[model samples]
Target chain A: MEERQRVRRPGGRAARVGAAVHQAVTDLISERGYGKFTVGDVAARAGVADSSVYRRWGNLEALLTDVALTRLNARSPMPDTGSLAGDLHTYAANVAREITGPEGLALLRLAVALSGNGQQGRRALDDLLAERARHLQSMLDRAGERGERAPDALEVLDHVMAPMYIRVLFGLDPLTPEYVDGLVDRLL
Target chain B: MEERQRVRRPGGRAARVGAAVHQAVTDLISERGYGKFTVGDVAARAGVADSSVYRRWGNLEALLTDVALTRLNARSPMPDTGSLAGDLHTYAANVAREITGPEGLALLRLAVALSGNGQQGRRALDDLLAERARHLQSMLDRAGERGERAPDALEVLDHVMAPMYIRVLFGLDPLTPEYVDGLVDRLL
Candidate 1:
């Protein structure tokens, strides 16, 4: 029936299942924190069979990685506002919202927890980071083509993203719009 | 008996027990990660009585907080090298080593794990950050008193400390001397 659903509706049922499972994962991370819940818990929460989750994601770590990547990437979307400053402002503001949003801390904590577990977890962390880096590099490259002096990808990570993540993780002050913009100004 | 030993040797027996317990906590965090072990586990690993652990720390969270604050503060002494440039270089280099050290990752992971747990965890996290901010502020104050320009304590944190910490948490690149020094240089 599950295979038939995938075949019949393609994006319709499969995407719904995927979204349900991802939401379940995020909710679990928020309530139970990392390493406390399991695939069965997620399956039960999502109202999907355990076998379906395993068949689709293979394991909890993969499901978590998928959730983080899909949600974070979908939330931020790369900005190309025709100027480097505008691009950075939009990009940094998007990140601030994503990290401070209802599901943001859960995903960030999931990434941190996954990174230290073992080989599989390490791979998941690497994939999430690589994807973000690639996304940001494309933006930087566009700036270069437009003859705008853009900082390196790592610089953006260090100056902008790193501060915001650290603040969120440590439960510090809010990532105000001015504060986020200040980071961009300093980098430029 | 513990009281007698404290009276007889002053800091001798008390200090030894504290060190042993803290080492055990670090080792357990390294091996088993956070929230898996308890006061009993720490006591057994340290070769001290559970009562002793409880008496000193009051509970597991308190013990963990003490370990984090004591070790982190000791490892990264605020450098006052008579120049802001010299002070920042030394300070950043010291932090680079502390986070990348053997026991460093465990303590850091513990902090991240604890911050999301509950009220006690939040307090522990706040204590750690406050101590760090206090230490850094002293260094910046010294620089200012010496008739040198100094960035805000938060700026050093945003620029120098945040990047190193985020990198460590995500298992990113090594904090090479050039990279650490560059953070200070840019801040200046």
Candidate 2:
């Protein structure tokens, strides 16, 4: 489904270049792991000059962060389903699908690796999570205003949204739609 | 509170050695990041032979994993407040306190750096999260049995437990007790 969506999305030259670079990085990370791969390898795979890659991203971590952010942004936004349960189910399913997918897992694996180092890596991960959380929070707030969710909409955001990443990134059990639905029904 | 609890748990020579080595690695990683640190540094700091560190944990990643897991286990268990809201509030507060603390942030930063690289690093992180989640799940299950929580306990776990980590790890707003209480009231 995500593959189909990516295929359908319009891509311009810069977007294409970004996509190519990001894909190259992803392929390398998935195949060789982070420690073994280098910016030079990324440059070669993307068919771009090392200088260009460095000029755009400054470092390997920054380049990976850009790729992660781009991939994260490409995910489907939360939907309004009238009821809290309905909205939560939609949100959970979307998250479950993404996290369970190859790209999401790859990013998660990358994030966990990068999270342990310095402030730059930490900030990059924090920014990615915050972006997603803010989006989910906005949708949740709408649900609250419409009387589909509780006054404290962030509760659903925390409980419903955070676990998918935890499970997927940590390589725990696969997050199924049923598991998400059950969570939404009880929590919301 | 964690300081008090650490004093209570006593162990043998191997456990002591592991603790020493773990602390050494953590300190090194905190100061120098994983990319620049090595087994020799960990050994020298721990006052153990270099081969001993390698024999016990294989690589720096494995050594760090042991350190993280041991430190995590040393924290106080969640209090059973007999209400889902109360339990969640306490849990969130505890998590908030940990994540905001110097050591917690340091570990999180380290995990991010290590997560980008190897399968071992990823698994190590997953183990850490799973250990914590299991603890939360046990508490939630107890709440459910007491009729203080929803029938579907995992929902409460996701909504209540997951978000606390999200906010702290991302370094967003401080996760206050009031926020946790609000979340619990709405979701539980």
Candidate 3:
């Protein structure tokens, strides 16, 4: 079995500083956007020294990426249901709630804007997406192993999850619980 | 019956000028990025007056948005193979090809980056997404009408299409035609 790597959660002074800096960065991005916000603004907003912000995150892109990841991790985990359909419904609802939330939408908008610029920005966006995909894949894998789903379950799982992001990211429509349930029924 | 929208094909001096300006903007965004590129730079690159560029597009955001939309429309239309499986395979393959292609990847990277910023930028990103979704939805809707798909065909379509975009946009993994086939088989 491949061992899952553990990520370090912020702790001690680093945690406190990270929390403050992240909150500041989020506020700045929401207020002025990535185009207008700067490391100096983040430092001023957080009431920390400029060097302190730079020492921790290295650059504006790195700082915002970290903040986005930290906020994501703080959210509730995907629920475990005996059935794949039940689990998917719960998962989709959770995702819909998060994506539609104020902070989530703001951060998402920022990531989308920054994703096309530089190598660092691209990697940051890719990393966040990979993390989420892995989580969804793991859940589907477990369902398959339990004989609750077919051997090639990722395809079905992807079909279910993809539309939610499409609806939200594309602004074509809203992702509602009804939509999620409809997807779960057809897919699983 | 709803009237079908005709695809605009650029011709004549004014149309050619617009195309040239759009190409320049795309090149600039790919090379220098949206954040760094300006209307003046685009006009200079296209060999057009700055006022001309502004007159054509109200602002830089509007210009880039229109350019992105035009490029997307110019791509070959999705094939109609009369079979959902075959059509999906073609569609997914096309998406994978574009997402992995040099220009496609560049544009995708740009779209992702800009997704999170100012209202104008966010709306632009949304419009690009809606065009693609509408394309997919139309295909799926046709299948449903023909009694060749499930009652909830859109959900089925979403399941198949979403993963490919998720993989490409998020850089989770490369999408293969085989995977697309598998998705179609399972979903259908």
Candidate 4:
């Protein structure tokens, strides 16, 4: 109650601090994987006092979950790239790039680690996947309207998206433009 | 170094202890998710001292990775079900079963958590996925031998296996036997 009132009081400074902290979380995750970070690390990176983070999000996993939500929001409402394939290719590329990158890789690790814990982490993961599915489905629907080919949204996600993730997450194969293109062609 | 010497000097007590520790790891991971576990928990569960686990595996992550390797070994080398569809159905069932089960889910979460930290955990995950791909490839090869249709190993993984995992992991859909059959029919 007190925290909510403080944020709503004025200037939106609390909001800015929240944003900075989240951004710092992203940068840190991107730079190093999630295993090595601490709340103090996040606080120092965000230029906020350690107590400010404790006062706000209360803990590391919660803060990280909040950060993941923001990242999801920033990435979502998938762009209309004309065709489902185009949207998928664009979308997959973004995901591929993020996971393969140092920061994104860290964030993904944290997500997996979180998956083993409580409902909050698992829900975040499920929601993230479902949200992407919704956006991807919109593009497929658009493709159908255009009289182009379209598969079930889930089918495309499973066939294309799952393998892409398996490969990227495991380093089983290079997540290349060629690989993404191939996934698009085969699925479509 | 001393521990290795101690194991070598024994009447295979080391082997028994090792197996017990690994089993305890699996049981705990299955009962709860990996997040709630520690070397101490594993030690107690195994009826071994914490120092035993510490001396053998050195850290929680290392122990977890070793446990993952064992699970992968136990799960792989799927039977020759005479058709790619049959083989995949059998194989995917094993995976779906594991992921849905507490043990498998915990292992997966661990793999994802490790994905960001070091190459060791990531490599274990990669090897596990690749091992499954190889077994799936054997079925594809057999299909080719019979002049039956076959896709590339990676494609098979992406289309057949990927969709199965996406559903099982995300709960986007049910992982019924009928569902696996449907996935096989579509991909094949």
TM-score of chain A of each: 0.91, 0.82, 0.81, 0.81
lDDT of 1: 0.87
Per-candidate local distance difference test: 0.87, 0.69, 0.69, 0.73
Q: Which stretches of candidate 3 lie over 4 Å from their true place?
A: A1-16, A31-36, A81-86, A110-119, A122-153, B1-13, B76-88, B109-153
Backbone clash numbers for all candidates listed: 0, 19, 16, 3
Tens digit per residue, CA lDDT, model 4, B48-159:
9999999889998888888887776686567677876677677767767767666666666666655654677767777766677677777788978988788788766777
- Give residue A110's error in model 3 in angstroms: 4.5
Candidate 4, residue A44: CA error in Å? 3.3
Ranking by lDDT: 1, 4, 2, 3
- In model 4, pairs of residues that clash are A29-A103, A30-A103, B30-B103
- Lowest lDDT block of 10, candidate 4 chain A: A108-117
DockQ leader: 1
Off by over 4 Å in 2: A1-17, A32-36, A78-88, A111-153, B1-17, B32-36, B44-49, B78-93, B108-156, B181-188
Q: Write the per-residue lDDT of candidate 1 for residues B53-160, one digit (tens) a residue.
A: 988889988888788878877788888788889989999998899889658988788788878877988887898789889988988899889898889999998999
Candidate 1 true-interface contact recovery: 0.74
Docking quality class, candidate 1: medium
Candidate 2 chain A lDDT trough over 10 residues, lowest sum: A148-157
**TM-score for predicted model 1 compared with the true structure:** 0.89
lDDT of 1 by residue, A1-188 (tens): 57655575656877788878988999988898887788999999999999989988888878887787787678889998998899999999999999895479988887887777678878878988998999999999999999999999999999999999999998899999989999998889
Candidate 4: which docking quality band? medium
Per-candidate iRMS values, in order, are 1.2, 4.0, 3.7, 3.0
lDDT (tens digit, per residue) of candidate 3 on A71-112:
765563767797677777788788778777557766765666
Q: Model 3 Cα displacement at B138 (Å)?
A: 5.7
